[model samples]
Target chain A: MFGEELKQFQRLGFRHVLLQVLNFASVIASGLMIWKGLGLITNSESPIVVVLSGSMEPAFYRGDLLFLTNPASEKYKTGDITVYKIPGADIPIVHRVLETHDVVKKKSKRSKTALTGTGEQLLLTKGDNNEVDDIELYQGLDWLERKHIVGKVRGFLPYVGYVTIAMNDFPQLKYALLGGLGLLALVQRE
Target chain B: MHNIFSRVNNVSALFSSCMMGLLVAIALSTLLFTADPKGNLNIASVKVFPMKNRRVSARKQDLAFVNFNITADLRPLFNWNTKQLFLYLEAEYANGQGAKNEVVIWDRIVRRKEDAVINVIGKNKYMFRELSSTFKNVPPAHYALKYNVMPHVGALTYGEAGRTLEAVPFPESRERVS
Candidate 1:
């Protein structure tokens, strides 16, 4: 089984194999470029996110995919589902905006961009399935500011992100997948 | 050119792309299902009192208690794609400093079309308070019944169902209520 492929590899020579490696590397690089570029256009650190918890159940399951966009000029309102990350917390939470207070801050030229048609808005979020609001989850903070939020959820996809979750749960599967793809790329002729 | 590996790869590639196209079409088809349902919402009563918040430091915060009535036939909002409806009551007001606020005092999830015809005499399910932590000099609030339509797949949509005809004013905070 190895003899035929070894002969082909020898025939192709080191320079041809190196060129193939370059082609494979470029393909991966371009994929990353498109993902990061989309994130920039959407103004979300992560343009797409997978639901990892059941807090927002009946609407989003554990592996559902969510699309997000944060329009810098727009203000979040009550009932909009927002994906927010609290400081020191690694995972983001998806919950609905239960309260929005546009508190009047002293008008300073430096903070002008923070003010919308409404004053600087402060938000409180609550999971639909949870019994109470997310005050306890804030970690001593009273309210969630706009900065802590990743984005407002706009579109949803069902269970498409389970592939990533499956890979995460099984490291062996991940390595096997990566190794198989690498071997195939090396062995296959254009 | 016509090897077994290439044939399997071509078939799989075509199959995945077709599935993607079908999903996109289903997501876009929601735009054509234009449904705006209307109903009635009334504020039965509103009372306020100064109370200490124990979760944080012991500081007096004006807590408003509200009782409301809702009668909305939200069946029109449900379709095969609709997973559920998140219904909520929001209080819209402005403080003395002219800062606007919208707060959801109560909410319920309706998972079935049979349960979408809502008729309830309910009270605030969550704590209702102003950002300044006082209802004194806070303007009267307008109550609106809104809904978020969550789909099994595709974009989520929102709409209003009903609103109180008049703004409800918070009564002067009593030191204590018997």
Candidate 2:
């Protein structure tokens, strides 16, 4: 029972509880800071991503952790794994680059995202396990531009991101986890 | 006091810390296996033809078909941590817009060291078309045989195995196959 915990909490008084709350807040703040710092260093919106689907099999399975980086000056090449989000699609896709076409332009305004070696790049992608190219997944678009791409997959970790997936699938687990952590933080002494 | 709650927490923390350390070690180990194996890549022929789009037959497109030969020894690339090797033949070219392009025409996945020996004659396996649907006015294209090393639990690495001695030019588009 929490009788002993309550007695300890009462003995600690409200100031100690406030101190504990402040400590918890700092812990969360530091976590967010580290995430944002990694984003800045990698030049990606989300430097770490969890594989949500099994489209890319044998290489990346669902629940795997993927590290990504989007170098602004670099151009995508064939066989490079990329995570991209179309305008209307809510979830991003991870696929290997299948084709890249450097289009010739007569006169064009400079785009904010300048790809390497000049001109705009038109890329086509496909999943390693899929039979066809990713043209159908582009949502009526012919090619995937640099803007639609999130980042290129660089490092990988297996099955670690499954915790987040489990939390997402079962709402009760998420609440139970949060509640347990909060109770522990509040009840713990020092 | 190592109560059930504290025991669970401590055990999980140690387990995860050990896992992180192992992952870091595996990631760093790939740095030690630096294999730069070279080979020969020859483009025997390049044939361009005006074709209908696979999806929309009404639209006309230019498709380049290439026949190539590759000879390399990639057994040196397969180390203890190596999971598989993804070998690809890519065509690199630039359009008038000065944009550089790389397209993989053929690819093979080598999962075993015995298959790492690179000696093959192959042709394009996927469609090879430009964004403009034509290769006309496109500069000469260079073909290179590249390989990507995937590890069991580490960073992915890339390297060039072989390249055509001279950039191959995209031949004029033919009306129909003879």
Candidate 3:
């Protein structure tokens, strides 16, 4: 049988518990809705990113939050910083453009591979501080095209994402911190 | 009055102890083995053509090109002794029909500073570039570039702590004004 404490609390105010649960559900649903909305509006799988490393130093530091947007109608250009995903890689990278060539137009009609469609293009990228372009990292990929790009870095907030960086660096700390915060939120009068 | 005063002091002590415990937990976590940001600097260029910005009004017979010019500033971050850097390039198409149509345009060792250009041609193309072993043979409708840079031996900041790598994209020029 349930304890008297549980029954008494339930009888005294089940409405408060219901209201809190509803509030939590509403917050989560709203967050998901916003994410989906961003995906649709930007036409990108990820419309936001956190700068994980100092690879883009000065412009973006570690823990900086970046806002991304990749409109289906917009085209990427040289000097533009973009976030793209590799076929098998889980994480995406942000880098600048290096080179590009329209290969579809290069193959002859009689060639083994001939393009009959339109809007064909390829591109290269490199980091701002490294010595060479990112050819080795491509894992035999020659160039990145429109489909691989996740988004483009449009804006960023510095140091605001330190908490995210900390969480990523120490996953246990993240859970502990969350649990502690929840307890505090529950116990606090205000 | 005495009972009320004692109760208030007890509450205050409880609150202060909770605060202290939280602070200690945070401090302990910071000192624990955390995943620090490694100095493994990786730089590469991925093809970005037919993007929203690339506007080409060329016929099937005309010459269409996607030029990618990438540059990197590896001053303090590059460790000459420890890191062995590798580079690669590839091409793909967006439509699933272009499975048999793919190419590895370039792959090489990056011992010096230079620019790499990888071009893909097809009526429809998508490209990608990566730096890990996972992106070896990608599916259709995508292109990619891959590269690996070794960390230089010895402790040397090619520059500052937060400022190490910088990539510069070559200016897009009109080579084939068809």
Per-residue accuracy of model 2 over B77-156 as CA lDDT, tens digit each:
99988888888889988776667788889888898999998888989988888877889998999999999888877788
For model 1, residues B1-178, the per-residue Cα lDDT tens digits are 8989889999999999999998888888888888999999999999998888786448998999999999999998998788899999999998898888999999999999999999999999988988777888988999999999998789999999999999999999988846
lDDT of 2 at B60: 87
Model with the higher TM-score, candidate 1 or 2: 1
Model 3 chain B lDDT-worst window of ten: B154-163
Model 1, runs deviating above 4 Å:
A108-119, B1-4
Q: Best-fitting candidate, measured by lDDT?
A: 1
TM-score of chain B of 1: 0.94
Per residue, candidate 2 scores C-alpha lDDT tens digits across A82-112 of: 9999999999999999988766544436653
Per-candidate DockQ vs. reference: 0.84, 0.64, 0.03
lDDT of 3 by residue, A1-190 (tens): 5495566556657666666556657877999999999988988887877777666544456776667788776656544578888899888888766555443355565764555545555767776555566767777786788888888776544566788888988999999987875544333222
Interface RMSD of each: 1.0, 1.9, 12.8
Superposed on all Cα atoms, model 1 deviates from the true structure by an RMSD in Å of 2.1
Best by the DockQ measure: 1
The true-versus-predicted C-alpha distance at residue B79 of model 3, in Å, is: 35
* Candidate order (DockQ): 1, 2, 3
